[model samples]
Target: MQYKSQAVAKPYFIAAIGLFVGQILFGLILGAQYVLGDFLFPAIPFNVARMVHTNLLIVWLLFGFMGGAYFMIPEEAETELFSPKLALLMFWIFLVAGAATIVGYLAVPYATLAELTGNDLLETMGREFLEQPLPTKIGIVVVALVFLFNITMTVLKGKKTAIATVLLIGLWGLAVFFLFSFYNPVNVVLDKFFWWWTVHLWVEGVWELILGSFLAFVLIKTTGVDREVIEKWLYVIVTLTLITGLIGMGHHYFWIGTPEYWQWWGSIFSALEPIPFFAMTVFAFNMVNRRRREHPNRAAVLWALGVGVMAFLGAGVWGFLHTLAPVNYYTHGSQITAAHGHMSFYGAYAMLVMMMISYAMPILNGKAANSNKSQVVEMWAFWLMTIAMVFITLFLTAAGILQVWLQRVSDSPLPFMVVQEKIAIFYWAREISGVFFLIGLILYITSFFIGGDKKETA
Candidate 1:
């Protein structure tokens, strides 16, 4: 709200929350399907619902990153956005395209969607997370370019802070890495190898840069920490992130028909991958402990702290659990991967985005911070969602261990479907936990509309 143009971020943030709601609903559907296979068998199959769930997650987080940049950059630069109109235009364009593409996935069969969207020419449809049709993929590149242009030009015309510079580099890397998704060679090995260049590199690589930058920006505002100190921590975090994560890509190569060397290389590097998250946890708590003054936004401060703890436990701890080659050989593609995917993404990216919303939404909505009641509710939502995710990961991890034991490790190995039958109890438990997650999401969306007394920070 420092500049009128900053208001543009409002819609982007709102859209992100809306999509997050959609993502959770589909997630519940997926969970139910895990236990009750025929719940929506043909009408909305597991794969369809899953695509909707995951694609929404990616799209919404992208919205969060973009909105965060739009809001923070102008303030850091000490000027308005360079092209507010372009930013707005890109918002609607990206939103509409994303919505249409998701609807296309759910409305029609995926193969039909691909055929209609001209994936026959590019053949980028069958990949794991890059399942967006060719047209959608092209649109993604276009939108990213425009977004980079607007933010880059604004930063150039205004101030150039370390945080802003690092953010731009991360965004640029995101766009560049995504290009690898288009390189769908015939060899399945090559396909998966390069695909991780986008998937792993984004989450584990450049996205960490964005995460650190945002964390620094929020800590500076809330903790009254010296800018120099926070930015220095930011740089250190990103450096460790790349040093560990870039090489951590080898872990994926272990099972992908790659050389045996990856097993050693991946195990060694990925084991150290949690260092940055641990550092992040320390950095966050240290900043709060040394705060010069308390900001009025106690809920925002709470979120900042929660991001540190949860990101470490979910991404760092859980990741290290199965990251070793020996354990992963049995656990790969099991419920363990699913567990890691759920918590790690939620802990690192999803919660980070929500933290930004919790911090910025009140200011954007014309209050220094939310009413104590509203903040209290928001905090409740945070705990509910976060705790629910933890149980879900726990349940999935249980299912995965049982599965690996029964099907892979045990002498009397059972068939995959037979093992699944044994694990039905865990699936049921996961479905039950997912219900709470959905409820938490509902509360999260509802907290925004509540009104109460606005109090200033210390």
Candidate 2:
């Protein structure tokens, strides 16, 4: 089937490149802040930089989702997007709004932004409810609703709702739920409650749908696997993720001064969270192994494989490591949490988005497939980033454990400041390792524009 507009995927590709560049810059700033506390502050404070980094990561991944949807929806539904122009308009509006929010973050102080927006970064590193000032908060809501409306209307009018479309709708729900955090009454307890609604629900809940669907799409395309079989696996993985994840929000409540009953609820459900990621690992490899024909995009397949394995390790194994209330009690707000967040989001979400974009680039540009050399470069970048992230996670995990042992567990624990001094080496190690991750990103970004030799189809 012909797409109504030939340029269906271009906007998403551009957004992906911009977001990737943002991710790298943010990484460098955050790494510098770790090693050198007084690095680019006042002009670009660490807190503001972090906000941009984290928020942009989310935004770009969403952009990647939108791109993937635009690229794949036509093929899946056997028709074009209901309105390509509307999709383009939604892209610009969201982009402009996202940029504005970043500017607001830099301009407003922690206290002022918090007071204005209701999101108190000073108190909790910006995990408070969506309470940004009225204008900024409203902007976020409007952008989200507009995006949801566009995607939903497209699906409804096209009369096409496959696994990919289902995932897109799930993403729309995630966007809407995030808006709820903006105005959920002014109680700390309730604020923390709904904050998880946005954070936990998105990552663990709806976004997993996006991840599963994208991975399934790539695997089926590259491996010549039967669509029905691959899609069924997609359904199973997302179903399991939501089943456990909704309850897993209790995990955060363990320390947030909520009911004590959450310890049981959170521990049990979160402990079970790894089951679906394990299923995903099995799903990807099994589909590849069972393929009816070999495809040219071996690198995309490799990335699909990497997503499965990494998701299992990052979201499953590492998550299980701290699922217990007894363990989390000591490691609650430490670097251990950072370890989990980095790997899980990067592995399960970020890399999957990258894989989707990588797959689409060749198709959109009319290349038969990605060049072998570019694929090799991407593979190297994957390893570089993966290994570096592993080192960072290990360093922080060890340091967090040590901190807990010395500061919380010992009979005569070391002073907090003294313990921090002891762990400074790990912080340095983390920063040094981050340099490799940055190098990987550099190579990955270079490859997109300066791609290697193209294959000529017979």
Among the numbered candidates, top TM-score falls to 1
Q: Clashing pairs in model 2?
A: 116-132, 116-133, 117-131, 117-132, 117-133, 118-131, 119-131
lDDT of candidate 2 over 405-458, digit per residue (tens)? 999889999998788788889988888888888888888766665554443210
lDDT of 1 at 103: 85
Error of 1 at 94 (Å): 0.7
Off by over 4 Å in 1: 452-458
Local distance difference test, each candidate = 0.90, 0.77
Per-candidate clash tally: 1, 7
Residue range 1-458, candidate 1, lDDT tens digits: 68888878888898998899899899889988887889988999998998889999999999999999998899889899999999999999999999999889989999899889998788888777889988888999999999999999999999999999989999999999999989998998998899999999999999988988888889999999999999889889989999999999888998889999999999999999899999999999999999999799998888889889888888899999999999899998999989989998998889889888888878887777888778888889999999999999999999999999999999999999999989999999998899998898888877877875432211
lDDT for 449 (candidate 1)? 72
Model 2 clash number: 7
Q: Top model by lDDT, which number?
A: 1
